[model samples]
Target: MCSNYDSVTSPERLRIYFGVDAPAGSIKGEVWPLYQAPFIRRHPHADVGDDAVPPREAMAGLFGMLPHWAGEVAFGRRTYNARSETVAEKPSYRDAWRNGQHCVIPVEHIYEPDWRSGVAVPTRIQRKDGKPMGIAGLWASNRKATGEEVLSFTMLTINADDHGLFKNFHRPEDEKRMVVILRDDQYDEWLDAPADRSMAFMQQYPAQLLMATPEPQRGRRRTGASPTSK
Candidate 1:
């Protein structure tokens, strides 16, 4: 399951690609569970006979989904990635799934561990075309005891045991999984698809269209002074 990724940080790119003029608020480039990031969803008035309104809109949301019953924001940490197979059955996700609260996460890249060498190495995965990926996800809203409204989302993942590219990551004994990357043309369809038809969009992205490279962990520094220094 994906717990971290790079969010699309360019407003121009968000406008040109996702049709979102700008993010709802400032967001960090590196995203982890519970981090604020942008997600695209069908406009609330899209079906309300407003021809002048855009069909889609971008909004800032926590990277992990929070069901209404969740007591605190911490609940998001464990709900960051929802299994597509069980999304409709899991209590934390079934409400959003049943209500068709579909959304698309604009991701620059996703980091996963590469264990081919008997050690875990961080790997960055992105589209071979170098364009942002529109990942399928579910969005939900909750109100805290303090009456603060929070918007959140979770990436949808599917089995990747036979995928040529993703099968190489993670431990060999662990079940392989990868997020569902939607095509450019399917964004609107995904947002508007009914609950029964949602499963139709859960297909895996073509492995040939993706590329991966090793990326060292961030924020590491030398422990002591330089050799030539004091």
Candidate 2:
């Protein structure tokens, strides 16, 4: 599951890369669940209808799927990562998927686990060439009883048992999985294509273009706190 990731992409680069006209305020550093991060989606045209909308624009949304009928924001915690295989069938994701509520979550890097030492170790994964990656995602609009609309999203993941790089991560007993990263050529197609055809894009990213580095766990005290420090 892609629970955390680096979201330091500047607004200027987001405009240039996604070709979005809407201004994207800076969302620097790591983004965790419930944080408002930039996402690119084709907004619905208010004057016209669902079919008519301006080009895909950048917007900030919470990093979890809070369905409209949900009573509280806490539901998001479990809806942050939607499995691609059952996305269309799952209760929390089926509505968004069938409605073509697709989105691209641009990020600098993603964090996963490496369990080689019997304990899960955090590792940062990034493109070998150093370009930003557009991860496939699903977006939703939740209307609250208090007359508020909450925009949220969830990353789509797939089984990666055969993936060379991704398979090296996660627990030994757990099934390996990875988020679906879209290529430059496939971005527009993924956002515009119908549900049936869009399934073709749900594949693992090539491991050749990726790299990983084990990182010191965040919040770890470097000195004077832990018993091992002395």
Candidate 3:
């Protein structure tokens, strides 16, 4: 599960890469559960018969998803990563999944644990080509008692038991998993896909296209260990 990640911070990057305009310094650099970050979705006007507006729009949202029944935003911590296999059946995610609330979470990199050496070492994983990844996700909106609207999202993850690179993370006894990183060309299709066809885009990203390195924790010294790529 991706509980932490680095979000794309530059508005120009968002406009050039994701084709959406966002104000500078609007998104946080690092994102954790409940942290506000930008996500891309099909513009509401597009579905309402507006032809002049852009098809896609970017908005700041909490990293974790909050269902309509959630009493507080803090519930996002456990809903940050929705398993692709059960998302449609899970109560917390079913509504968004059923409503075709598909979205893309722009990530600079994601952090996972490298338990290869018996100790859990923090590892940073990113595309080998150094491009921002648009991970497949679902977004939802909830209203607070004060009538304020809160938007949130969750990354969709798939089983990676046999994946070349991701199978090496986590512990030996745990079920391996990785986020569904969509190809650049699939961005529009993902947002427009129906629930029945969304699963087709949940395939794992190629191991050859990704690289991982040990990222020392705050105040920790850098290690001489070599980075890993399949």
All candidates: TM-score: 0.93, 0.87, 0.91
Return whichever of 2 and 3 wins on TM-score. 3
Candidate with the greatest TM-score versus the true structure: 1
Ranked candidates, highest TM-score first: 1, 3, 2
Instruction: Provide the overall lDDT of each model, using Cα atoms, as 2-decimal numbers.
Output: 0.87, 0.78, 0.84
Q: Which ten residues in a row have the lowest lDDT in candidate 3?
A: 221-230
lDDT of 1 by residue, 1-230 (tens): 77778999799999988998666677878887778999999999998887799899999999888998888887787788889888898988999999999999999999887899988787899999989999999999999623788999999999999998899888889888999999999999999999999999999899999999998674222331111100
**Ranked candidates (lDDT, high to low):** 1, 3, 2
RMSD of 3: 5.6
How many clashes would you count in candidate 1? 0
- Model 2, 50-130: lDDT tens digits are 544656777777877887787787677678788888888888888888888889988888988689998778899999988
Candidate 1 has an lDDT of 0.87
Tens-digit lDDT track of model 3 for 123-213: 8999999899999999999886226788889999999999988998888898899999999999999999999998899899999999999
Best of the candidates, lDDT = 1
- Decide which is better by lDDT, 2 or 3: 3
For residue 19, model 1's alpha carbon misses the true position, in angstroms, by 0.8
